[model samples]
Target: MILYHTEPDSPVIEISVEGKITDHDLREAIERMRGDLELNGKTRVLERIEHFTGIEPKALWTDITLGVSVARKVTRAAVVADAVWIRASMHLARFFTKAEVKAFHVNELEQARVWINT
Candidate 1:
């Protein structure tokens, strides 16, 4: 399951994912993120995903779609994940998107927030 919250006023979009991530959850997160981008226009975004246990292959595809979705709307995107693979993939894939992508551990969430906000 995924739990998401957006602070449009603060111009920050935050998303939290827990348990195993399925395709449906990924789609929902993507849709919500898109809405935030459309609402705020080129805002900074923060995604916290340390609680996420695993992901389905379809969810992996959905993640790429979501990245593209965000890139089209946001100027910067920061993701916090303890998962090594996710961190690696995001760093490598950032070059393909318009949004500058950065991944951090959960402990670095605050720093990431500050970096993106700044």
Candidate 2:
């Protein structure tokens, strides 16, 4: 599941993911982000992943394509996850995204929020 939090005229987008993610969920989230980018030109992202079991194969593909498509439009991305593998995956994702991507432990969510807001 994915939850998005954004306020009117805000340049920061907050997303929270839980459990398994599907291709539809990814596509919807990406589309919303694209719409925000169109209006804002550039934006920062704060993503929090909790109990993320995994994603479907098709979801992975959609994520890659959509992420690359909007790479240059994102200014910064802060990912908060406790899993080591998730952190490693964030590093790999950075190569495909233009945003400055950083991974934080769950305990450091406040710091991550500050970084993204800055």
Candidate 3:
């Protein structure tokens, strides 16, 4: 399950994932994010991965197709997770995405927000 929300009047999207992301959830998130990006021209994403089992193939494909331009518009990313693999992936994302990505442990969520907002 995915829980998505935004900080009002701010170009920040907060997302928490448990289990897997459904296509409906992905679409709704993309819509809101796209609207924000269109208005602000850039965005910051805060992803909290608690227990991300995985996303389905269709959801992955949808994300890929819809996220290309959206990804570029995200200028900052704050990832809150304790997983080594997620941190490693964030490191790799620096090379591929325009966003300045930072990873933090679950306890450091506040720090991540500060870093992303600054």
Distance from true position, residue 26, model 3, in Å?
Answer: 1.1
- The candidate that achieves the highest lDDT relative to the unseen native structure: 2
Which 10 consecutive residues of model 3 have the lowest summed lDDT?
87-96
Query: For residues 25-110, what per-residue lDDT tens digits would candidate 2 score against the true structure?
Result: 88888989999999988899989998999999999998777767876688899999878788878867656777999999999999
In order, the Cα lDDT scores of the candidates are: 0.77, 0.88, 0.83
lDDT: worst 10-residue window of model 1: 65-74
Model 1, which residues run further than 4 Å from truth? Answer: 64-67
Candidate 1 — which pairs collide? none
Please state the error at residue 18 of candidate 1 in Å: 2.1
- All candidates: TM-score: 0.79, 0.91, 0.90
Put the candidates in lDDT order, highest first: 2, 3, 1
Count clashes in each candidate, considering only residues at least 3 apart in sequence or on different chains: 0, 0, 0
How far is 12's C-alpha from truth in model 2 (Å)?
0.7
Error of 2 at 91 (Å): 2.3
Give candidate 1's TM-score. 0.79
**Candidates in order: C-alpha RMSD to true structure:** 2.3, 1.4, 1.4
Q: Write the per-residue lDDT of candidate 3 for residues 6-78, one digit (tens) a residue.
A: 7668888898887888888888888888998887777899999887788888888888889666777898999
